[model samples]
Target: MTAAAPSATMRLIEASTMISQGAEAKIYRARLHPPAASSPSDPSAPDGCVLLKHRFAKQYRHPTLDGALTRARVAGEARALVRCLRAGVRVPGVRMVDAAAGVLGIEWVDGASVRALLGGGAEGEVEVEERDDGEEEEGEEEAHEDGAEVALREYGLTPDQVMEMIGAELAKMHRADVVHGDLTTSNMMLRRPSAAQPAAELVLIDFGLAYISTLPEDKAVDLYVLERAFASTHPQSEPLFAGVLNAYAKGMGKDWTPVSRRLDDVRLRGRKRSMVG
Candidate 1:
């Protein structure tokens, strides 16, 4: 198959609306598939909206090398998402890929980031909509609106339950030998369940730093990062994190022993480094 040239049609980019920008890529809300106005019966066509991640040009690097680097990264991210999907991890599905332009489109998850849902402010904190002055101001909201209390009412789950889901998902991913190099609450989402799915699901996102690895140490480090994230963002959830590990251990089944030991080692090393610094 002939690969699309660097100048290939970038209608996908043209249709996208930039939503947020991070160090590695600019994200946009876009439609991957052209409207099936002619053939609504097309079985291969996917959803209307998609999230596009574009790794823009870097002026510092030489043009040829930069283009190659960008393409490699886009491919890597797409591969990671596919790997998670096969492993039954609730990651957004990839819809389109334009490696030449360093753009990768994925399913647009329609729900709140776990960060915002947990009172961790928001992931990017970009204000998109304006509220009326008559609307309740920020301070007027009850204290229960702070964290998981609202989740209990809306999602019917508490912080502990969400933590368990996070742990189980991480376990499943690690069991599939995919180590998420960056595991943080901000990198997860709570997809609101629909007719297809009955209950809300915890979905891990931003797999830009993910890689395949079978090593227990790598998985342990991943768990360690998740632990620190919980401690920092939802301090009250720290105690319940043991329950998360128990859930993870149950999910891991026979593979839990070694990862558990390695996690202990990682925590010790982390404390030592903190003390030294």
Candidate 2:
């Protein structure tokens, strides 16, 4: 007998434009049609475009094991997103889910990544500078800071305000027990401000490695991860991160005391605990 063919969702993913590929999954920008009742006037109406995250099969694992893991991860991510939404966290809404095929569809966000907005170069774009004497350039250090200010102005916010938004959003997520395993500027997005929504909202994305946890250590580690990301990606961002922490404390309220103290301890010991036997 011949082997079974791929499912419709898999076929759709195959036809979609592959936007980004990582070790765990491949992201695609695709248009999906809504249910018949969604738009009666246009029965064949498209459900608008979406960002699809397709978790491909892992070759190393057994077929059954791989399928189980993929489905579990897809389900976990979808659950986390829904939980965040209900908790008033600003994140992309889920549009579709195909756990069997390991495909998850989310609303397409129209703005640039936070990394790009901060002038750290566009998503996936890297710049390598070659110096003859292998020495530092004098004014190069100030270039990103200046560009970031201009970018923030376009969004009607200052660097400090942006940091505050980030902190608040993360605190909201943690309060809901949703731990974003990977926290980086590249994972955050600033949706373009509009008349209806005057403020440029900060959206957290890429929850492939997220889970539910209420531990203070977990929450502190989440903040620490973001702090390190800022230190590495954005130069002269110490004050900006401080602003984020301040806002985070306010959002966390009474719970902030423990997490704040844990954060200091995390910084001292680093991300990983010493594995001394």
Candidate 3:
């Protein structure tokens, strides 16, 4: 299926700031409409700020078929977000959807991705201002420039605390029976603490690959996916991941044992596949 570019979409793109792009979609930091006054406006006022994910239309398929599939996928993501929200899982609220144009707009999260916070490279981060030519780019090394401890202190967090948040949040999401098919630190954000909201909250983003599943196997795989992501993204991350699992287990209550056993099995399969490849 294919979608003819809408003029409105083009205008939105022109006014919005593109933050990242993937094979499936392009993300933008955009406001639904212009600020009431260009001069100055209330910071607390709702400006319809959103993180827009625009799914590119497939050109290989018939227009009718592609349009239907695109709409279904967009709707699926929105439904998943709603499910997570109802289950008390922290996630961006769906703001608007234009299935015909394959666009899904969600609440703008004001913070940094967990990966960036944990010293993972921020390849597509949106910065508030451009640094001067002499400034160094912030990355894994930059995050730890002073010291890991000092870094965490700046954010009022410890490595273990972040891990616990990750694990508990995943369990909450799983309890709601929503499988985040692609679980990674980059997909999780740490909302900056403010005077109004003193506690930093973790918010899950990107439901493009999320789906509903009651199966324990799916949940286990979700954990396994995150495990690998942690291993590859952070140094000496095994202990951190273990902490996450512990928190996850506690959050799961009676639902932990089965998923834990399944996770072990998934890990074994992953090892075997790696050796085979």
The models' CA-based lDDT, in order, is 0.80, 0.85, 0.82
TM-score of each: 0.83, 0.87, 0.84
Highest TM-score model number: 2
Candidate 3 regions exceeding 4 Å error are: 1-10, 33-48, 123-148
Stretches off by above 4 angstroms in model 2 are 2-5, 34-47, 122-136, 271-277
Better of 2 and 3 by TM-score: 2
Q: 1-277, model 2: which lDDT tens digit per residue?
A: 9989988898888778898898999999887854445544432223466899999999999999999999999999999999999999999999999999999999887677788777667655643253799654777657757778898887898778888899999989999999999999999999887766788999999999999999999999999999888776775565689888989999999999999899899987873453531
Model 1: per-residue Cα lDDT over 1-277, one tens digit each: 9986445336656656788898888988776557567645443233477788889999999999999999888899899889889989889988888898888888877777777776666654532232675454464334524446776447767877887898899889998999989998889988877667778888899888889999999999999998998777655456768878988999999999999999999999999999999
Clashing pairs in 2: none
Q: What is the model-wide C-alpha lDDT for candidate 2?
A: 0.85
Point out the higher-scoring one by lDDT: 1 or 2.
2
Per-residue lDDT tens digits for candidate 3, residues 190-252, read 887777678888899888899999888999999999889877766434557889999999999
Full ranking by TM-score: 2, 3, 1
Q: List the residue pairs that clash in candidate 1.
A: none
